[model samples]
Target chain A: MTMRSLTGTGMTEDGMDELLAQFLVEAPELAQQLAEALLALERMPGPGQALDAAFRHAHTLKGSVQLFDLPPLAGLLHAAEDLLGALRAGDRAPDAAALDALMAAAGAVEGWIMGLARDGAGIGLPAEAAALGARHEAALRALLDGPAVPAAAEPAAALAWLPALLAEAADPLAEARSGSQPVTALHYRPAADCFFLGDDPFGLLRRLPGLIALRVTPRAAWDLESFDPFACNLDFAALSTAAPEALRQHMRFVADQVEWAGVAAAEPPASPTVAATRDPGQRLLRVEAARIDGMMDMVAELVVAKTGLAGLAREAGGPATPLGRSLAARGAEIDRLVAGLHRAVLGLRLVPLAQAFRRLPRLARELSAQLGKPVALQIEGEEVEADKSVVDALAEPLLHLLRNALDHGVEPPEARRAAGKSEAGRITLSARRQGDQIQVTLEDDGAGLDTAKLRRVAGERGLLPPAELDALDEAAAMALIFRAGFSTAAAVTGISGRGVGMDAVRAAIEALGGRVSVASRPGQGTSFRLTLPRATVITRVVLLRLGEARFGVPIEAVAETLRLPEAAITRLAEGEAFVLRGRALPLLRLSDLLGLPAAPAGTERRILVTAGPAPCGIAVDGFAERLDVMLRPMGGLLAGLPGALGTALLGDGVVLVVLDLDELAGGAAAPLPEAALS
Target chain B: MSIALEDGRLRLAGDCGVEEAETFLSMLQQHPGLAVDLAEVAALHTALLQVLLAFRPPLAAAPGEPGLARLLLPLLGR
Candidate 1:
């Protein structure tokens, strides 16, 4: 097998490089989140968790990229970090236009990361970085400058300090003494929310590099009137002769908040210094996954061999056979130990869900911006774990849902305000496990679907009859959004007016063995919920037999399996029907759907009544086997055949096609008639 | 410095690659080897695993960090 094929999915030869790539993947998302949060803060004028979340995510990306020495990305994040830091400190939050600039800068940095990943080395980005720096400085200048400074002068003033500072700051004397010096400084401060971020103030202070001298001064000796130990009010001063650039680099993320001064001397001032050090001799020893797989194969062989030996020993049973008994016991223990080790080895490949969730806020915000709507997004259950490839595949379609919500579900500011709602709409995005499946829900509280408009659109498109459109209630009308060419927007916008988006979303969700459903109200907003299995390695299916042919049904949709007595099923005009628990369900036989022969006479029929929220049932001849196996979807002509979701290989080597129960049972429109059933 | 073989021990000298595997294996085939040194190897990849698996040789590992050893353990199981 090719090395790429053997290592399983998403394992990179260089983990740090992969992590750097992931950082790029995550940064754009964080930038987008900050924009949305800024919008929310502007509209609601209250402190919400989204801003803090956006800040933390950006901080995390900044930290990860810093480890890789990606200076430009680090610099952009540093500016954003400063803005968020100031906002967190109770300064007036950034305005809309400033937030828009930051969002664009965020996009640029993300694009840079992607560029770096695609190419092994990053391009010389000095010009682009300087331009972004100028833009950020201009915004900061505008924020700090009052009406006294004309708005256009803010950019000129921000640029004014650069040349003089750059030229005068270059000191050759200091550079000569240090052998080649750039800059150096010492910064000291008590950490903000140190207790919450999980750090001990004194311990962190003690660990500072290049400690020329250190002293911690207690802010309050404890007045009985007010003394909060948890509220750390301590400050420290340190004199470090490390290069100011080194000091600044170390303190980059928190540079703005901390107080620091440049050290004029090249050497330390009579204090111990921990010089920065790294051993470049280190190398990553690579291993082939197939070798591990081969080892596992041998272990399996050993298990089988031991089993045979134990069986032989049992067959030759005798009380005096202590050696045989000992061998058997030892073999059993070895088998258990090997199995445990195998599971641990497999677990090393699992990655956290944060990698996926980290990108959503930015995407949500960007989509909202492009569609010209205000959306406040709240993401929960971000700590869920899954395989990395699955997470990568999830980004595009989830992003599409975000765009769909902003483009279609959310009403504009005037519409929301007129409906007695806050001008900024809310989108709550969450994921949690329901049974064996992960359920991701994207919900928006905007102007919900107008059933009348949906009816008119459906009638005009000739997708649904005017009578049928009239019959559809709010929930059913919203379902039309998933139909191909079913957009409700009056004019084509960049985001979703083409009408081809949601159909693709449906296909993508279903392709992953998941189902997507929409629920909406006229004035209350809309929600799209998707449920998918945790892993695609092995699929669990419910097997049904028709004549000699047996097919599999996904267990997710099988509500209940039953042995239907003849009296329970009642026939209706042009079709069969069954009344169960006060609801009339239309019955379609699996044999008829598959064009298979009928079952023999005098045999009791077994029917599996499958339905989702919309109840229906399918009658089949007999119950066969429910098996778990590796599933591969049939390609070419067989894939287009009605009702088959995918096919799996049964242990007996027979190929069983898995039926999509919802598509088959939800409607009475059978593609094949009894004449076609042979 | 690159990886080399000495006294039945695989001494990893200047980071050499799998193109040299045949010569190393032929030498090993003539004299069954055990110990291996990774001191000189700057990096290793899947090709080394393929070589080790091809020979099914038990490795008597020289000094290295646990991470290096852990990465090689599966292939060494052969």
Candidate 2:
């Protein structure tokens, strides 16, 4: 038991930090490039330069995985390299199955890299990861030892199976074809004694992706009187949105028993990552994102230091003297230099939204199959750049919106045609740089929100009273869907309609200093536009004193501050309220909110009004200077405390607790439950 | 017995194994309108589930388990 504690030894060992950090930075880029190389190889008639490059990248990745002492990941990577080596040696052609194995192996390594980034050397790879690694390794090894990737099936054999599956799964396959993109049809028959061998064939069939249709039939006519329950006598066939290559990869181990038919040529992958890999800057140096952030913090320090020197020159000899004038000139020079350096470092933090768009293509494919409404996603301005933190945080909200577009907005094929619209739906995602802000637009050409329906659902769910529903205008009524617990899904799906609805998406965008709005034209489409800061540069925070401690509140959240006479504040039964502009506004004492002792009776203090939902006045003892500083998110022992955004450092090296006005005003005074972190 | 008759419904709770399939089949045959409830089951063996699939008995309650529902829902014509 004590030996498990010794695992910390890996982190503290000299030089491991730099080594692990470098590994984290280089591995993901390398894996990305390798995936591109594999894609090229898959599309080629015969491998050439791409195969050699892929082999080299796989070799490099395996070495990097081994450096972190992750043997299982290394082993999986090694098998993939071995298969690539065989292809290079002309021992085997690069078949779809082998390429599938290699691509999946690369994806698996990417996941491992993420875990390592989160926990560093303290992470022991999960048992599930090890099992997945073993399976990938086994499949690759078998490919190396077995015959070449199976040949394309005969046309006559396909005819025998295709009609049966369609007939069996008629309803499921009806809306499956929205356009000419392509569909993969498969027939899989397990061994006769598979059940005795502990293989539930139906279980594997159930896991198929985009499984629009599936049918099970007895291989030989079932003789009920003589039937044996334990004997596996069934044949399974399915139709899916998965591509032919993906289907081959999924059924790799059972390839001999499976037959793939009716597969159209696959469309070129529309992933931004694939385009990013072909980038001309392949030789660009890789640097860790954290190191670039640290540089930004240092730039802030230099600016502060330069400002302090100006005050010193005044005390020494007023600005007219030679010493004072020379000091002033030097300070001006330093200021110019610092501004240039700031821009250069901030440039390092600007990453294209491309990386965030990688999973989008796969998402659209799966959704198309599930809803039986084909959606074509047109992405524009992926080259638009934003702060790396902003790029990363926007992924989930964007995914939720995309899911919502497909799940509820898009109509089934027949319905769209009946409405005099195109059979296939189109979703356009566009990004642009608007001065200091980035505007992202998601527009789907589908059935737009029905304002009347929205109002009815809101009233039916008791989220609003009949009077309020009747009084609201169309825009406000449409916005009701953003309220938590509001859902229009006829039945809950595991995707967009899961309990976490549009409200979570709005909260996330707002937390990043962004605003989201929705507009729709009934029968035309629905569009969502989100405007976010290009970067949250140098947070301007107003410092206030609470019980001998100073806390910072983001200046954007503070509406105004005033020194009020004792006669102004009125006591109410609930707590306190102040009359402002002929209206009553709630007032909460900072000390009371933080659960600290009350101020002495008749002590004079200033009031800070917050400019958001539940507009309120917060009374605190006093206020200090408003300054721009780098805010670091809460970590270690201070982590998970309610209403805490992060911390900023003051000149005296004191930590100024930054408050999230939204969390505080919303009244979540307790720490978040542990389960919410995941 | 993992398959217990409760009120008019057969409650398939906990783990129902292969040995229980015959008794389940007998119960289905005897009660023409028999429905199975899976709200409390933890791990249901394939043989017992196969019986339910073959008979297409009305489900009083679907399994609280997601994997069970995900695997068997489409097959039950839902």
Candidate 3:
């Protein structure tokens, strides 16, 4: 039946679309979990929790897809659930063909979900899905009829090798044969260029949980003088008593390179016992990020209103009076409660970096294959938590960076070998929490930054004048890579030498109120470090007043607050400057910088020192109390304005325009006020 | 379906459906070196065939039915 006939019954088109979107986001994850569980069941067929999990995944998919009334898709999952139920009840054990059918059904459902996501809910299941459903139904019928004849046992050649290999490792194989657990014999012959694709045969072999025996042999005799270390010429055969699921999972990434079978001699365990452990309690709730962001905005508004209320209560009477004292006491209590509430809400927004890191290994593997460079990716500190917004925004930039590392940073195997390094290059992607910020660093051990080449390219591109380029130090010259249209590659390749440079990476991170930096040494390696805030819901700001309008500067950016007398300020040819601890700190007037009305300057003006590599002092008419305020990035026309970070509501109900100190300091080139020196 | 041990031969005849798979498998497992005679077999279910393939015993006589030979002989790589 057509999808429209099923889906358009009770729900509106918009409702269908919303549910489709949710299904698209959620169904694939469930389908993947189900696929893994089914593989586990195929390896160790028994009445157990694995079967239950597989059943639940299929059942959940059926229920969700049924919501949209996709008949074929839902029917496929239903058939799968029945097969699983039969397996769980000890009605039948799924042989190889049965497992294949189950996998095919799960895959068809996933494909339908993708189609729905791409074409909206109006899209119907393709004919292939119907065919797959029919196949699944047939398989289930056969299974229910009773255990079909198992496939022809292992091929004769494999059978012959099995005994010889077993004879070679008699003791362990004997022990393994005594157990009820099934034993899998695997023969893995990786691609000739598997090394280039970042396949670690040894590492994968070592991780087999119940390794019984392992043999590694050169596929052919090596010629001493003509040997190519870069090429993978090895064959690996292993016997592991590991659960079939574990073996399959370990080989999943390189499935094409391996052949595996369960030895017929290793029968199902005698008791066929189920695992005693129950499924772990699921503590996580899958909520849309936008909802959490909306809640955060509301909490910000409530905190502002609460602060306003406390201000009014304090103004109602002095602390000496009974009413004033009581209001003051209540206000303090509310302050504590609001702070606790704010923290609890902010905690909801934090997610682990692993969400983004998990997708990198595959990317590295694929890119390494494309570039013909073998790269070992080591990921560390994936458990570090950051704002969900930050994690979501990080994915694309991290992809670009990893692509760059694989393409440009990692040298070819021959080049690496010639340089006295291993033929396979290494890339390390690590994240760590330092104070309130998360530092994600990607380091590569290959050819480092060629500063001389970068400087030459920068000069040729006219990004900076020759004199300025000459004056730049090594670090500053290296920083030129972030300039737009900057590329140091001699020839453009499809992978990274596209016109888009590190400039885009920096721009994206900076847009998130974070900064990106690079450190590299010639002949060593390069590391890119991104420092981002742990959460974006609320920020501590130092409030300053210019004219009647108040503005908030992020407290992290404030170096020191001081009363700078007019006598101490000096006039420079460029603009106003002040000597703070023997360093010339550029001074900017906040009112002049933001193009706001200037309040009449009073003697001994308050100057807020902005901290960074280049510290700058901003003169304001007065200083207000510090606060933890919700900072929202400006929207609409104000979004284009320079030096405005976002807007925040204050205790007194005034909207504080938070300033972006980096932009303010960089753009302060207006003519100095001659009247200020008077 | 009938399975009998006669004259050191495991003889099978008639329809061997999935219900007879367990009995067929146990007989094959108990007598590791027994010869199989499928001369009078009518229909052989896949489950029973799977058990025969797993045991890999020597066949004493080819199936009387050409269709059974076509279905079962190549699987034994004869």
The numbered model that scores best in DockQ is 2
> Interface RMSD (Å), each candidate?
24.9, 3.4, 20.2
Tens digits of per-residue lDDT for model 1, A283-394:
6333444665455444434433444555555665633588667767776786677556544543443444445655666666667667667777765444445544445556
Q: In order, how many clashes per candidate?
A: 17, 0, 2
- Flag the better candidate by lDDT, 1 or 2: 2
Highest TM-score scorer: 2
> Which predicted model would earn the best lDDT?
2
lDDT of model 1, residue A10:
52
lDDT by residue (tens digit), candidate 3, A598-638: 77766777888888777788889888877878876565667
Candidate 3 stretches with Cα past 4 Å from truth are A1-25, A31-291, A309-325, A462-476, A483-485, A490-493, A497-500, A544-550, A559-573, A578-584, A589-607, A619-625, A632-656, A667-678, B1-78
User: After TM-score superposition, what is the CA distance of residue A24 in candidate 3 from its true location, in Å?
Assistant: 4.2
What does DockQ give for each predicted structure? Answer: 0.01, 0.08, 0.01
Candidate 2, residues A376-472, lDDT tens digits: the string is 8766556678888788888988999999998888888999999999999988877777897889989999999999999988888998789879988
Answer with 1 or 2, whichever has the higher TM-score: 2
Give the range of the ten consecutive residues with the poorest summed lDDT in model 1 chain A. A269-278
lDDT of each: 0.57, 0.73, 0.73
List candidate 1 segments past 4 Å from native. Answer: A1-103, A118-352, A386-390, A471-473, A540-626, A631-678, B1-78
